[model samples]
Target: MAEAEAGREGGESTLTVLVALGANAAIGVLKLIAGLLTGSAAMLAEAAHSAADTATEGLLLTALRRSSRAADRRHPFGYGKERFFWALIAAVSIFVSGAVFAIYEGIRTIVGEEAEQTAVLVAYVVLAISFVLEGISWTQAVRQLRREAAADELSPMEWLRRTDDPTVKTVFFEDSAALIGLLLAFAGVGLHQLTGSALYDGLASLLIGVLLTGVAYVLGRTNKGLLIGRQADPRLVRALRDDLGARPEVDAVVDLLTMMLGTDQVLLCARLDFDDALGAADLERTCVAIDADLRERFPDLAEIFLEPVPRSDPTMRERVLSRYGESTGLGRPTP
Candidate 1:
C-alpha cells in the first residue's frame, strides 16, 4: 500500500518538473536567437538565465527519481537524501551560470562603445512574445502553488517556507526568475530604444544578474537546511502531541522528535510514559496498542520508534504519589 502511494507521488512531481523544463527550454532557445540578431545585451542575459534554469530543473528531476529508491542492505533508511543533494546543485547553477555569466556579459557590453540597434522592430517582437510565454509559465507555477497552499491554508510565501516538495520549490523559483527577467529585458530594450544607447541595455542586464544572485543565495541556504535533517514541521509536532495525549494508554507525551525524510514521509521517535501499569504482558500489549493508534492518526508516518517505560524510580514514584494524588506508571491502587 505504501509503495503504491509512493509511486503516485513520484509521478506527480516528475510531471510538474517536466512541464517546467519544456517551457524553459523553448524560451531559452528563442531568446538566444533573438538576442543575437538584434544586438540586445539584455535579451542575451535573459537567454543565459533561462538556459540555466532549464539545467537546474533537469537536475531536480534526476534527484526526485533517485530519492525514491527502496531501502536495502546498503542503506536501511532509503535514499531520500538525494533530493537535498541535487537541490544544492541547482542552487549553485543559478549562481554560476545565471548570475555570474550574465554579470560578465553585461559588463562587457557596458565597457564597449554604445551601439545602435540595426533592427528595433525585431527586438520588440521577440520581447513581446517572450513576455507572453513567461507569463504562461508563471501562471502554471502559481496554480501548482495554490493547490499546495490551500492544503495548509497559507499564502504563497507561507507555503514556500512550509513546503518540502522539491518540484513545487523548483518551479516556483524558475518561474519567478523568468517573470522578473522578462521585466529586466523590457526595461533594457526599452531604454536602449529610447536613448539609442547600448549602455542602458547593459545596465539592465547587470541589475538582473544581481537579482538572480540574491535568489540563488536564498535557495542555497534553504536547500542546505533541508539536507541537514531539519525537523518535519512544528504543526505536525503539535498535532502528534495532542493526539497522543488523547489516547487512554498514553499518560503524557514526554518528548517526540520528528524529521522529514522525504516530502511527506517522516521518522518519529517518542518517549511516552504510560499511566498505571500492571504486568510485563500488559505493558507489551499497551505498546502494540499505542503503535496502532499512531498509524491510524497519521497515514504518512513511515517509521515509528517508541520506548515504553515507567515514569520514575521507587523513591520518585513515592514522591509523585505523595505530591500528586497518585503516582504514574503503576500508581497507588484505587480505594
Candidate 2:
C-alpha cells in the first residue's frame, strides 16, 4: 500500500473508487436510520449489505495500492499478485459478513416479526434515493471495467474470467449484484408496504444473500487458482507454439508447457526439434529465437526452458508422427 502513496499513479482510478466507497458508507448509515425508524427488516438488511460493500471497496483500493509496488529482492516479480490474494480475502468476508448475516436476519424476521408497515411513503422515498446512489456507483464501475476489458480484447464476461486483477473484477461484479439487489429490495419493500406481508421483504433479503454468496464463491475460486498458480490459457499456448515454429532455427514445436507464476507471469518449458545437421551453435541460436519471440509476445514471463532436440531423433520424430502422421504413401504406390 505504501507504493500507492509513492509516485505510481493512475488516472482517478484510486480517487473514484475511494469516493464510491465513501458514498456506500454514507448511504448505509442513512438506510440504517431509515430501517430503525420504519421497523423495516429489509431496509436493515440492505444497510448491513451496503456497509459491508463499503468496507470491501476500501479493501480493494488498498490492495490496488499494494499491487503497484516495484519489484525488489523480496518479490522479484513485483506485487501484482498481491491484489488477487487480498481480494480473495475480501470475497470471503463478503460471504461471511454480508450474505450470512443477512440470511440470518431474514430468517429471524420470517419466523418471528410481524408484518409491521409504518409510513410506507417514507420507506419508499428512502429506498428510491439509495437506489440512485448505488446505481451511480455501479454504473461507474461497469463503465471503467468495460473499457479496461476492451483494451485487453475480451468480452465483458470473458474478461472477468481471464482478468488477473481480482480487486477490479470483484468490485465490478459486487456493484452489479448490489444494483440488481437494490431493485429487488425496492420491489419487496413496496409489496410488504402494500400487502402487510413480511414474507416479501424477507424473501428479497434471502435472494440478495444468495446472490452475494454465489459471487463470493466464484471470486474465491478464481483468486485461489491464481494464488496457487494455474496453467497459461490453451489458446495462448497454441499462439506461442506457432510463433516459435515460424523461426528458422526451430524445426517444429515438439512439446510445450506453461505454468502461471503470477497474473501475467509464465514459466514455459518447451522442446523444439532442430535439424540433425545443426550443431550446438545453431541449436543455441534457435533457443535464442524462441526466447525472443516469447518475450516479444509476453514480456512478463518469469522463466523460460527451451530444450532443443534433433529433428531426426526417434523420440522426437515418433511424437510428431503420432500427432501429424507420416506421408506413408500407402494410398498410392509407384508402379
Candidate 3:
C-alpha cells in the first residue's frame, strides 16, 4: 500500500511538473514577444521568470530520472541524493537567471537607460493569459499536496514542509512565484499607463525579482538539508521504536536509527535484545520475520538491519552497569 501510494504520488508529481513546464514555456515565449512589442520592463521580467521556470522544470525532470536509477555495487545506497543535488541546482538557477536578470533590467529601466514612454495594450492581455495558465499549474500542485496531507492527517503547510519529494515542492513554489510575478507585472504596467512614468514598471520588476529570490532561498535550503543527509521525521522514529518494542520476541530495543536514502527510501538499523531461549536458528528466523514485517509496514524502509544482541552479552551488560552504577542483567533469565 505504501509503495502504491508512493507510485501514485510520483505519477502526480510528474504530471504536475509537465503541466507547469508546458505552461511556463508557452507563457515565456508569449511574454518575450509581448515585452518586445510593448517595450515594457515588467513584461520583460515576467518573460525572464517564465524562462527560468521552464529551465528548472527540465532540470527537475532530469533529477527524477537520475534519482530513480536502480542501486548497484558502486552505489549501494542508490541515487536518491541526486534529486536533491539537481533540485538545488534548479533553485540556484532561479536566483541567478530569474532574479538577477529581473533586478538588473529593473535597475536599468529605473535609471532611464531603457525607458519606453509608450505601453502597449497587448502586454495586459498576455499578463492575463499567463495568470490563468499559472493558476492552473498552481492548482494542480496544491491539490496533490492537499491529497497527500489529508492521507497523513496533516495540514497543508505542515505537509508541504515535511514532504520529502522536492519535485512537487519546487513546482508548488515556482507556480506560486509565477502568480505573484504576474500580479506585479500587471500592477507595474497599469501604473505606468496611468501615471505616464516607466518607473512603476521598473519598480514592479524589482519586486518580482525579490519575490523569486525569496522562493529560491527556501528551495535551496530545503534541498541542501536533504543532500546533507537529513534524518527521517521524529514521529517515524518513535513509531518504529514502539512497533519493534511491542514484539514478543524482542526483550528490549536498545537502539533504532533511521536515515533518509531518498524521497521514498529510508535505511533503518535496529539493535534489539531477543529472548534468551531463542537458538541460533530461531534468531535467524526471527530476524527474517521482523525484517519482512517492517518492510511491509513501511515500504519506504528500503534497507533494514536487525542486530540481535544477546541480553547476557558481558561487554554490553558491563557497559550498561557502568552507566547505571548497578547491574540488572537487563532481562537475562537466571539459571
Candidate 4:
C-alpha cells in the first residue's frame, strides 16, 4: 500500500513537470519572437525566464528518475539524494541562464542608443496568450500542492516549508514567477509606449532579474539543507518517541535520531533501555518483533536501528543531553 501511494504521488509530480515544461517551451518561443519584433527589453528578459524554466523542469525530471533507483552494494542507502543534487543544479541554471542575461540586457537597454518600439500589437497578443498558458501550469502546481498539504493536515505554506519533495515546489515557484514576469513585461511595454522612454522597459527587465535571483537563492538553500540530511518532521519525531516509550519491553527511549533519506523515506535510530529481566534470547526476539511492528506502523521508515542501553548511564545521558539539550527529557521517566 505504501509503495502504491508513493508511485501515485510520483506520477502526479511527473505530470506537473510535464505540463510546466510544455507551457514554458511554447511561451519561450513566443516571447523571443515578440521581443525581437518589438525590440522590448522586458519581453526579452521574460523570454530568458521561460528558457530557464524549461531547463529546470528537465533537470527535475532527471532527478525524479535517478533518485528512485533501488539500493545496491555501491549505495546501500539508495540514490535518494540525487534529487537534491539535481534540484540544486536547476537553481544555479536559473541564475546563470535567466537572471544574469536579464540583468545584462536591462543595463544595455538603459545605457545603449535609443531604439524605437515596433509591432506593439504583436507583443501584446503574445503576452496575453503566454499568461493563459502560464496560468494553466500554475493551476496544476497549486492543485497538487493543496492536495498533498491537505493529506498532511497542514496549511499550504506550512506544507511547502516541511515537504521533502522539491519537484512540485520548484514547479509552483517557477510558474508563479513566470506569471508575474508576464505582468511586468506588459507594464514595461505599456509605459514605454506611453512615455516614449526605454527607462521604464529597462527597469522592468531589471526587476525580473532580481525576481529570478531571489527564487534561485531560495531553492538552492532548500536543496542544501536536504542534501545535508535534515531531520524528519518534528511531529513525526515526537510521535515515534512516544510510541517507543509505551512498549512493555522498553523502559525508556534514551535517544531517538531521525533523518530524511528521500521523499517519503526516513532513517531512524533509537537508543532504548529494555526491561532488565528479559533473557538474552528473549531480548533478541523482542527486538525483532519491535522492528517488524515499527515497519508496519511507519511505512516511511526505510531504515531503522535499535540499540539497547541503560537509561541511567552517565555517558548515554550526557550524549543525549548534549545533542538535544536538557529540555528533551530523554532517558527520563514521565511523572
Best candidate, TM-score-wise?
4
Candidate 3 lDDT tens digits, 112-228: 764664547799889999999999999999998898889878999998888788999999999999998999999999998888888999999999999999999999999999988
Residue-level lDDT for 56 in candidate 3: 98
Segments of candidate 4 deviating more than 4 angstroms: none
lDDT of 4 by residue, 89-119 (tens): 9999999999999998899999988889999
Instruction: State which candidate, 3 or 4, has the greater lDDT.
Output: 4
Q: Where does model 2 exceed 4 Å of error?
A: 1-16, 300-302, 309-335
Candidate 1: count of backbone clashes, pairs at least 3 residues apart or interchain: 1
The true-versus-predicted C-alpha distance at residue 301 of model 4, in Å, is 0.7
Per-residue lDDT, model 2, residue 128, is 82
User: For model 1, which pairs clash?
Assistant: 277-330
> Between 1 and 4, whose lDDT is larger?
4
RMSD of candidate 3 to the truth, in angstroms, is 4.4
Per-residue alpha-carbon lDDT of candidate 2 for residues 1-335, written as tens digits (9 for 90 to 100): 42242223343456557756976887888778887887776777778788778888878887777876777999876776787788888888789878987787678778985867776676778778887887777777777678767867888888778877576677777777777777877887888877889888888778878888998898899989888877676567767776766665556666666767655567788776665677888777767866786776666566789886554567666765665465421111112
Supply the global lDDT for candidate 3. Answer: 0.87
- What Cα-based lDDT does every candidate model obtain? 0.78, 0.73, 0.87, 0.94
TM-score of 3: 0.89
